[model samples]
Target: MRQAYSYVRLSSKKQIQGYGQERQWEAIQMSALAHGWDLSDKTFSDLGVSGWKGANIETGALSQFLKCVEDGYVEKGSVLIVENVDRLSRAGVNRAVTLLMQLLDSGISIFTFTDNKLYEPNSPNPLMDLMGWALSAQRAFEESERKSQMILNAKAKAREEARTSGKIITRRCPSWMQVNANKTVFELLPERVDTVRKIFALYINGYGTPRIGRLLTEEGRKPLVGRAWYPRSLSRILQYRAVLGEYQPTLNGKAEGEPIKDYYPAIITEDQFNEAQAILHEGGAGQGRRGEDMRNYYAGLLRCSCGEGMHIVSSKVKGKRYYQMRCLQYRISCFGGSWNFNKFASFTLFALRRLPLLELMGSRDNGNIKQLNDKVIQLSSRLEDSRKQLENTINAIAELGLNELLQNKYKQLTSLIAETDSQLHAAKSALELSHGQVAIQKEDTQMLTGRLLELLANTKDVDSRIKLNQVLRRYLSKIELEADKTNELRYIRIYRKDGDLLVTAECSHRLNNALFYGSDGTTEAMELVRE
Candidate 1:
């Protein structure tokens, strides 16, 4: 008996009211049964995929079908079953005909259920090929053009309405704002209003886009929709006038097209938004290049008190190499100046040495640990299930021979299995790291202190120093330096990695003599303070 593979497809989302996948499959089933062809279980269905995209495109089910054919999965003399010729493709008259001819040339016979016709490899039928295939292509092209005209007409109506009644159509709402009951006007999402305010505050406080993204992520603050904050996404928020209740048609998230007032509720005041824009306009100093061998160890770590990043600038004088950390916006919007590389490095080391090493390796509660463990187990189970499904699908496809129609499911299963495996591996790694943390309680502090002091002294090599710095960064978020009122003393303010100020100290220029300001209603917590 000849092997038969069923191919079914829906052109676009507009076809929902038209013939459905079930109807197409039903027709193929009846036709295959009547022809005595052995139908396979796997049926290729490209739902919501545009036929105009064609087989050369990377996406859609048809692309995967062609890939299977190229990989020598579909054998010659196999019967290809479809509800209709248009179900195979609506790429164009010439392209569709050429593709069908190629399949026929390969010894495959195409049986169209709708027409109850058989297209053979050698037989030429101009009437069926030209009239049937060509008409489908022409109809597809006309439908596509009609849809484009409809969109243009809708956009024109929306534009006219916005001009007259101040109401514009939007596809999606902004994170900080929501639509009203009628979906005609925008309103503030109360919970997200504070988030939008905080973003502006961060920008005004001197944190650049990249730094703000990191700060939000570390603080466990998610965006209005997505998992993590993006710098460009933040930049758009910074520049968006919608926070001031203005309607702006954005092109690529930038203000370009048109503007209307009072389209959205004001989440942030106009003055505040204007000030934030001014601060953002004064762009951070771009990191050019330092030296060939010398690298800035604190490139991403160092921040200026003026809310700008300190980049490394290298200079060679009298054959001696020198590096200095200068604020990107120094002498302009930033009053905080530059520092010598040695002085910056030494100050950072001094601050790091004074850190509580035991507390830095803080342990999570039993509940948190259990949650991580459970996550790993859950992901591993899912990974295993996906792998089994993939294996079963592959075996079924191989048993009936390589059917191009079935390969779309194979590709999807393979991708799903891979994604699950990756997620599982990441979960396991996080579980192991959580378990590995050496939490030193108050009783064990003395022992840990001695070991830490010993390690600090012995860490002389560049590699050892780098590792020690990395560990310090986990506990110490930033080190902001500024001169005191008298300009006789420099202050080194230490912050936690979560952007919280932990300790502030007045120190000598070299950070040799240090006195920390305490918050326990006293001026001294010289020992160690931890959460």
Candidate 2:
């Protein structure tokens, strides 16, 4: 007996949960019985996959059926049954026709059960068959296109309402929040809020995403979405400005309009959020997995005067272990002199402990901050003007029909809007850093300095060393080392995040000591430079 296989598709979760699949299967069975074909229990299903976008063909079970047909696993005389031609595809007329022809050319008879239509392998009325397929494809495409536009329109209306009324528009919100019964307000999930706050606290305390994830998992804390905490998810949570009660409207996955501040209940303070952003900007957080031991305390911040990273190398000679810091390009250039890692680390720690924290935090250029704020405002106005011009051009084109001048103007406005939007984003990021610097200056520097001194004293373990390195990066930008022509004296420069010089020192490898140099051409021995 000839064999028949059923194909079913439902484009949404709601459709999948309804009687769509069962109805299709029932029709397929009835058709197979009527034709005396053996209906195979193994059926292909693409549930909750979009046919309009060809997702069903790309990653769904329909792809597997195509593979089977191409490999000759399904016999030439076998039957392929679907509820309607749309179940096979709604990807538009050209693609739909191509798919229909491919299946028919494979010698598989397609039976669409909706109209009891059998598209035979070699139809006598080929033109009629083609017309029928084309019409069905066109209908499906039009319906899907109309539905998509309706959805876009509805979302635009909701966004407008949200902007004017400050009401929650959609059920989709942060994991820690939910829309109220009338969808006019958002309510926080207390448990998830606690988790979010904990994540930010852990990140500010110098724990990387992977480490934070592991810590949460070990403590048996349940994630809002998944069974276990993931590093990427934790990192995203730490970066979300939503915790600060801000909502950035997006269109087609890109930020669209101005951000709405104070849109949700703030989970963390602006200070805490700014601090976290500062750490992220310095590339301190989200360092993937680490080894059992951190070999260098100055992992990313240390570099040679030749603009190359100072990589660490370790070796064991007989019973003694030695560590050396060398330029990454030393073998090729030989310009960056090597230093004993232990002595260099000690000297750096000593100088950092005595540095004034308040001065470092307040070193940012107020002029630069003001310039960025002005740039943000100017770009925002330009973007609004360009968008309005684009909208007006679109209206003109609709009224007067397409012309060379209008088309050019539309393209120009589109390009201008994109460029201005990009500039606006960059300016906002710089402004965020300025705000973070201000927050840092407002902090209790005396207490912070005391904490720093304590942390600097406790770097014996790998975890402590890693934590201290990340913490120092929040304030200090980079440390550069150079050597005199003799290669005996190593000169080190410590720079704050604002690019201001914090300290300059010279180290003598022979004496295993360093001397701090003041800007007034005075030198103080390391022992005399007190905290």
Candidate 3:
């Protein structure tokens, strides 16, 4: 009996519970059992990994497997069972082909269930073995491409439907809404409908989204059967058009949906909604800090003894435009206040020295900046779309004379604009900040891979804590201060990059990564190609 290795893959969660991998495993095991392959050997498997991203076959996994074969871990000419060829690769198609050749050269036999084809290295016809794999892979490529196109087509259809019908076809909605049994249309939760009405009424009475949100929170407005109101939920309530009693105007010949009243119960009359919208569009009164949610690149990340976000707020501190941040919390209790940018930056520079190696997070490849251009374009477009939608809603409310609602919504929209602008400015400013990072990443990776790679290329010493700090702070986590002292010390909380706001929870993505590597984990690292 020959020892055999089995490989199987399922792309998503549904497939896992649906027995996709189980069926594949069973078929391969049955084949091995019937053929009398060695039953005593251990099984090798990668389960519930994607066929879309790197085929779960790249990223050192496949490399280790090939090394195993070369080391004679399995019998020569032994069978490798797979659910199908694509399980081996839906990515790196060319690499998969070359690897197949290598396996054949090593006298390995391949067996698959989808086509019931078998590869026998001893077979007289090399074409039979080669053609079976080549054709199956070709089919996989075609199918994947087809699915990609179909997804695009579906999204396009959704957008088209939205534009033509004056309806934003929601992919998701608030918890207080229930989808019809068919699961396409949505209706208000009867238990929570009054809360929705109150939200609209508050909004219609010149309360901004955030304030209205707070009122709901104070009221303990839990999702019908769930907990507190999420920001998204309050946001939705303030945005719903049914409160205005009409639909948005047809733009570019796309408006074709049933009018606003057809969707949900109206909370505010159209006229009231319009009046509210007008006040909002005109910017009646100031409320909330400008750009409160969007942290400045340096301000929030930098620290002072007080622990409040160091406010780099320009003020006439002896009549000069200066950037600074201070612990707002310290103002009343400890005379905590903002700091000048120059002093704060200098203090932070020393902190940077603690990191033995720093790499800017991104592709370190020469083409990375070019790759980032595409992302910039995509984010820009989405941001613009969001702005436009906000505008349309504001205008719709104004037209209906909902001044109070308009005022409230305008505040939210204004805040969103300010926040977005802040982030855009930070990204632009940090473009330079990332320079040292990119250089460090390149240096580290060069050691890892460039001719006779040194594994721990970035480490300066056994206890080089700051080296990890540089890369981790920028590329891995968004940070927040947890505690601060009058002295120059601070405690912090962290979240994933572009992840959520500063969470107080002790657990974090960074802590988990540490546990993964433990103490003995190899320190060799790859550099990002930020060129």
Candidate 4:
């Protein structure tokens, strides 16, 4: 018997997760071996890549082997085994034909393990059978596309209905707005609304983005959407011209290219929104680097030395100098090179600083790192205890019958689980709590660490500036760098309080001098300071 290679593939998601691929591979290999074929030197390969995808497979050893056959690599009498016809290709029309014929004309005998059919070049009905397989592949492709389009259309229709009816549509809402039982307009917090109202008032009073964000966060105000009170959200509320109630449909989350439709109850007027913008950009103090941007650097390229922010600070050749664009999140600036924007423009140059960032862009801690072994032991003991208690409770219930027993045995079981969890937490804490010890939960820690290292190693298309961000997230928080020259980013600080995992940007003047803005002219701006 001629030597042959076995090919295994999954054509559809249904089949991909099923036993079909494994079964097919087993059947073909077994049959070939049974027929007195010497298979010890041969390779059994699987093209795990989805067949419908048109990209050439370089990494797929099995798939590449098939291609090699088509390229006159193997003898015509050599066997090419596939589990099923669909496993060959779901790519439609000409592309599908080109691939199928490549395998066929290579003179390799085609064998389908499932149907037990063999196709030889000398077969009279070869053309008819190939056509049948090709037609089936085309149907699967058409069906997949049709399903995708239907889902998208449904989503669009649902959004439209939600906008018109004034009822919130998505289960996913921002942090502040509480979903009501009836699913009505979001329940805006009365206290937070006052903060929102005051933000507008501050903008009217000539305050810019920095002061506004600081004031709100200092007052413990949060955005209507997300949990944290982000500066970007403040900008959104300020830019919304309809806050004064002029009623433009664009004020809502309408897409730009999309035809604007009348939607939402407009609270502010367009004039109010525009006035806020004017306040943000006008006057000697209000001169933005080039329209009040939220970003402090060129697409997050710079960090404040003070760990606040380093915006293009401008100051007039004046007596009392003030800084702008410094973060107010921190008590003080770390970068410390605060200047007013008006005078700084001459030095900073015409800053187009256009955003390439158009609104772009998880761990369960079981055992304690310091105390993993202790935690595991403690948890095991606790679990054992819970089991005993549960057994006693169950037996008592049987003896006492329904009326005399505990009201909810299930609830008691839940408490037992909680108790076990607490014991585990304590044990883990104790083990890892020692100063000079490796992590107790080493397995989970290693997994997370490995993933982070993978992210750092990928240098393709991304450079050092991007690397800084990856580094900041991995080792530090509130990463601040200062610019001494045209593009020298120095004076780095990571805001990592000891044993605290939360990493937030510290918004001191020294820190924010070279940082960018996060407001959209709808909010107030703060003066940058040099500390």
Candidate 5:
């Protein structure tokens, strides 16, 4: 029995009229019954997810389905059932075509319930493939354009209304103010207003953001979103001009419409607000030291232990400034601590020097050559099969009357043959390119090693470190830091350009501490372990 996986998607929560998930589900069940496809227990449904957003496929149920396909959980002969082409994707033609090709190339048949049509790997209809994909993609583009215009019109009208009526229309008033349902009237929440005033007073009295945050936490004063207060949150409140009764209309956190002055009762005087801003610029709580520049050499190559990207942040200790790498998600919820930039960079150089550079480069070149050769062989075989199928189809057409079904089949076979021929040509070209790369690497093997070693050895200065980082990034894909359950750095995994793990070394912090604190405190006395 052929297994079928149904994928359903509703772009919006307001889709209750014709494009509801229930209607799509019923259609998929009926189509499965008629086609003798055994519907699997697993159904991928992306409710309230707009397929037009390119992010939809990278997240949610669609991502899960793609993972299953990649992991071989869905067999080659499996069927992917969807209500329509748009249910699979409404992204642009490039994304849609790429996804369709991925599914078809895996030998999976796509069954669209709306048209009761089946799209197979070996048989492709230009009309069905091109028209279906193009129509859905076009609809997505039109819908996005319409929504954008609507938002612009709405904002413009709101700004005009605010200008004439002395009222500010907003999604949410400040934490100290409350708006009526229509947002035409604003009233002060006495307790929250008092808290906002106190925050402004604290900043004016020389309290920095971190101190203010600590004071708020101690007082049990809740913030707009969460219970605890972060320094950045307090900094934003101090910087906001809304405390002076000014309303700034923003779309996506960017100032869009006009600003309305005296929109609400003032919590602090404009003079006091200006003074606080001056203090902030003069290296107040939120501001790092002035005239101090820090560069993050491993900006794009470092990953946190929790699989999050690490970002550079500056900190001050005893009048000295330092730059470190912290997880980007640390502000929200992640607990992974920061890594000293210089320490991490030195450790990276040490690890790379210990590696057999020439052997690794040779292996990388040989691996690429082998993979390209395999791809060329596979495409050549498929091309030969497609040619044979097209020849047989043409012979059949000559013998029989040109029936509509036979004619459609002939067209499909011809399309498949053309597609296969194109793929074969691409594979041959790629094979040649890989061979050329291998030849170039072979000729410059010594020179490349010498350049890399020179960069690694002279990375004592910031400028040299930057050059070394760039060279390392060209050879290495990423360095992922994994943490233990206790939140300690466990190990750092290094990957080459091909996504293969090159080494798993002890966490740099551990090595650093051991080397600096070992007996005799000498470099020759240090021991290294690889795991």
Candidate 6:
């Protein structure tokens, strides 16, 4: 007897729970029995898989069946039964017809229960059968296309409503928040909120995501949703603007609309968020996987004249270990030599102690603030242009209908608008923080400087060193080291965060003594004039 194989497909989980699968299987059994064909026990079924996108053929049971037929397991002249042509594929006319032709060419006959028709490998009227297949595939394509447009329209409407009114568009909020009964607002979960604040506090106090995760795990604190804390998950939480009460909707994994501010209750202030961003941007927090004893205090802040990081290199001479600061590109560069770590730290501290903190903090003129403001203006102008372009594209689509070029341009504009808006927000936040820095009181600045000095002087533990590194990054921009081979000295230039030269110093190569020089004539020792 001839053999028959059945293929069944349901587009969604809801359809699987319904009578779709059962109905398809019953029809296949009846057709097989009527034709006197031996029904195969192995059935190919794609449950909760989409046929419109051809996922069923690409990775689903249909793909497996095709492989089986190719391998001669299904045999020649075997019958393949499906509920309908659409059940096999709804990708489009050309693709669906191609799939049908492939099966027919392989000497397999297809029987559809919907039309009660059998399509043999060599039909007496091939053109009529091909037309029937085309018509069915076209209908499926149109139906799925219409449904997709409906979903897009619905999402657009929801986004508009969210912008006009403060409506919560999605229930997928931050881990610490939930949409209210009316969907007008998001209420904070008290316990989760506390966890978020604690995470931020630890990060601000010089803890990296890895260290924070370890600390939380040790304290018996669990993540809001997961069983254990992960560094990457914690990092994402720290970067979310939702914590600042902003909602940014996305479509197809790209930002869809303008971010709605105050959409949710603000968990952290803008200052706190911006401060954390600054630290993250600067790579201030030690990201090393070393134990509690961090080796490099100047992990991110120190640099060589060759524009490479200065990493610590340890060596033992006569069974005594000594640490030296070497350039990351030491093999490629021949201009500089290594400096003793202890002497370098002492010279840095000596210069910082007499840094004229009041004078530096009291000055209201900051180049960084001006640059940030300029960037904000540039990005704002770009964002406005992108929005106008997006509006014109939408108008064109409405008048001329959607084309591939117009659709691509629309996606590009939306993505550009989202990216520019994010940059603008960051610039504004940085500007705000810069302004705050200039307005610090003398007493607070004094206390902060004193505390920093104390921390730098007594960094005996790894945690203390890491905290000092993070804190130093907030005020100092970079510490550049250049070797003066002729004078047998190493020159150090310390720059403030505002891009101002704080002081310059020189240390003997022997690691014995050092001299400091200010912009003025003030000096701790003999001043060597630069040619």
Greater-TM-score candidate between 1 and 2: 2
TM-score per prediction, in order, is 0.50, 0.74, 0.41, 0.36, 0.50, 0.75
**lDDT for 457 (candidate 1):** 56
Q: What is the C-alpha lDDT profile of model 5 across 1-531, one tens digit per residue?
A: 899998888776588445587888888898889988899999998887877775568897988988899899999989999877777776767788788888888888888877777888877575677667667767766776788789788988977777777756675778877887776678888888888788777665445566567677788887865667887887888778789888887777777534688877788876566656644543452222211112655646788867788877788999998877778898577776666665666556555555566534425544666877888788778878877877887788899868897789888877886787678667655565555444434433443456434744555564444344434554667888655647444455667766766666555444453222111222322234442
lDDT of each: 0.64, 0.81, 0.52, 0.49, 0.68, 0.81
Let me know the TM-score candidate 3 reaches against the reference structure: 0.41
Better of 3 and 5 by TM-score: 5
Q: What's the lDDT of the predicted structure labeled candidate 5?
A: 0.68
Question: Which residue ranges in model 3 land beyond 4 Å of their true spot?
Answer: 11-22, 39-54, 58-78, 90-95, 98-109, 113-128, 147-174, 182-185, 200-215, 223-531
RMSD for each of the candidates: 23.6, 6.3, 25.9, 27.2, 24.3, 6.8
Which of the two, 1 or 4, has more TM-score? 1
Error of 5 at 180 (Å): 1.4
Off by over 4 Å in 6: 180-185, 225-227, 287-350, 358-448, 451-466, 473-519, 525-531
Worst 10 residues of 1 by lDDT: 285-294
List of clashing residue pairs for candidate 1: 206-307
User: lDDT tens string, model 3, 1-531?
Assistant: 687777766776788789787788789888788788764345555666655566465653455667778998756878888777888776545655776888877888887766676777777888766776777677777787888789767766865665565344553544456556665666766657677677655543334566556567777766533466665566555555654443343334655332444443345554444434433433421123323322233422444444445454656666755555556665576553334444333223222222222122333343454455555565566568768868887788868877877778778877776676556545433332244234445544443233211222323332222223323343433445333324333333334355543222221211121111111222221222221
lDDT of 1: 0.64
Candidate 1 local lDDT, 299-364, one digit each (tens): 446777776778877899999988777788877887665676665555445444455553343433
- Could you tally the backbone clashes for each prediction? 1, 0, 44, 70, 0, 0
